[model samples]
Target: MRFLLFILICAGLILTAESCKKECHDRSNPDCENYDPCYGKQPLTADFETFEVSIFPDNWIPYSTDTLASSDVFFRAKEENVEYEWTVGSETITTRSFTRKNFPVGVRIPITLKVKRKTDFGCFPTDSVVAQTRNIFVIDGYENSKVAGYYQGYHTNNAADTFTVCIYIPEYSMNPPHEKTTISGLMNISTCADNKINVSGSESVGYKQYTFLSQDGFCHGAWGRVRVDSAFMGHIRIDYSYLKDLTDIKSQVDKTFLGKRIN
Candidate 1:
């Protein structure tokens, strides 16, 4: 009886050792059924570019469900024979490239690209899933100013109140034509497009409308007429008011400034 019990214990230990051997096999082992060829490697990358398409506010709403203006974005993949998954805002698409035409202004929108190679299991090393994101900005006609760059000038209301104005587009590479102005050095001022100004002129360099809110709670609204001949020059007469409430207007201060593009 003692000998039989010893044999049974030996058999159990051998079975346990065999199970451990199978479970301990690494991906490099060919005999292992779960071997992986693309272990510990990122074999793919997702990349794309963007372009902007601006439209008038009156004719912007083509669809009832659409949010903002439309943009023509061109996306491209670096690798061939791969599956693509794109997430633009709340929408997902499997196409390699498509024009996404619904985004809001004055905000940053995220565009994501996820990809993986689609090949035979053992034909080549399996590619790991690669995901990349590029934040985009969609601009209306006002934001898409051709005179988008740095400028140097001073406020004409007060001689001692010197300031530098920067009219720029954020994330210039991925978004459509739009501009954001920042008046720094003297006082910190930011662009405020709460109220749109209507102006009629040439699309390239004519009349551009803008609104600015300073740190001192003053809202400045004006239209700047830019001339692009030998140099980029513009003058603006802005009516500023201390905006305790944006909905209601009261006391106002009028100021003027002339700016030249240094960059």
Candidate 2:
């Protein structure tokens, strides 16, 4: 009878041990393939909330958003519990659009976006992104002047040979200068008729100067000259001036009884 009681006690102990083992396994195993319970809980991403800024008319400045869209600036989420902050280097940014107000022509403006995210465990993750727009206000080869016109001129010696020049000014800049302004553009001396000049070059406007050379033969003549008036209202009056020769003029009038020619 004692042996029988011992055997039953042993069986009960074995069953209890097996049940405890099964419970431990069930509690520890994760549902997903990796079986890491803390995987999603940890913060894993850091990124910019926006990648680009939009400018609007009347000095409207628009900022980027975190949503996913073709137009929306996209940033990869680094980790969970993220926070975003934006900064514009220049105050000239007016309105919802990134209108660089009072921004100097040929200046490069850098805009920054900062992102902060935290994990479920209270750890913070931070990251930042930057976008740069160079000479955004001034178009290439176009400088501070606000004048636009077609000017033609030639070297003083040649009347038949001619050259054409174009000047472009920014739409902004109240009271833009009319004189003492050097307008630069590309010129094809060989192919004047084609006139395939690039107003804007590889560099942004205000960053570099552009120059066009007149044909070699035209350089020696009274080619051309154009001058802008003194007014500061973006109005440029272009005048084409050429050289003239007088062949029938006499140097001296009748010198009485002298060897001088008569007028």
Candidate 3:
């Protein structure tokens, strides 16, 4: 009886070991059905492989939404076992929107996005992307100058020509003490039709009419010069303003800047 009991205990132990072995077998290994040498010793593949990030509108604006259009910007993480972080060097941004009371002018803020992935073995690798945002002010020069600039080009059917407005700053000047200078401001235009003006052939066409201010801070001023480009048409109808300001500077751009399509 003792010998029989010992034999039964040994059989139970052998069966338990075999059952565990079968349960943990590697299906990829043909010999795993009976004996898997690689069982419990399998290699691991890193879960994280790739990721992507992006910013919306691809441009930054410094004025209030009522005065200027706002854009949405964001970044995304696409890998497993990965973590993400974002930082802006100057202004505080919330989910891609600037939240500061005032954006510092003439400053470039670096936006950084970082991604880190961890391997099964506890090894970590990192990736990063960086961008920048510039601050600028908008000034309205057309309202200050009463001259209406007309749009003239081959794409008139789809394009409407009107006075271009820009932001102005006293600091901008072509020469001398560079006293108070007038720059362009937020763009608002008056079509020719709105002003009771006639549209002729490839000549000149107008759509709307709007009042502009003067250089002396007056409400009504006539434009003095007119300028047109692939992107905008400037009319210096108001003495306080000019047809257009320098395009190389950000402060010179207004709503009319969007009208010009540069090839």
Whose lDDT is greatest here? 1
Residue 187, model 3, lDDT:
26
* TM-score for all models, in order of appearance: 0.34, 0.23, 0.24
Question: For model 3, how big is the CA root-mean-square deviation?
Answer: 18.1
Per-candidate Cα lDDT values, in order, are 0.49, 0.33, 0.30
Alpha-carbon runs more than 4 Å astray in model 2: 1-29, 37-81, 90-105, 122-263
In model 1, the runs with Cα more than 4 Å from the true position are 1-43, 54-72, 119-126, 140-146, 149-260
Q: Pick the candidate with the highest TM-score.
A: 1
Model 2 Cα lDDT, one tens digit per residue, 62-96: 22332111122223323334454435553332222
lDDT of 1: 0.49
Please give, for residues 1-263, the per-residue lDDT of candidate 3 as tens digits. Answer: 99999999999999998887788656556746755444453232222111111122122111111111111222222333334444545433233222323323333434444444333342212212223232322223322211232322222232364433432222234576543323243223342222221211111111112223233312122222122221232322222132343233333322222233122
**Which should have the higher TM-score, number 1 or number 3?**
1
List where candidate 3 sits over 4 angstroms from the true fold: 1-82, 90-101, 119-151, 154-263
Candidate 3: lDDT over CA atoms?
0.30
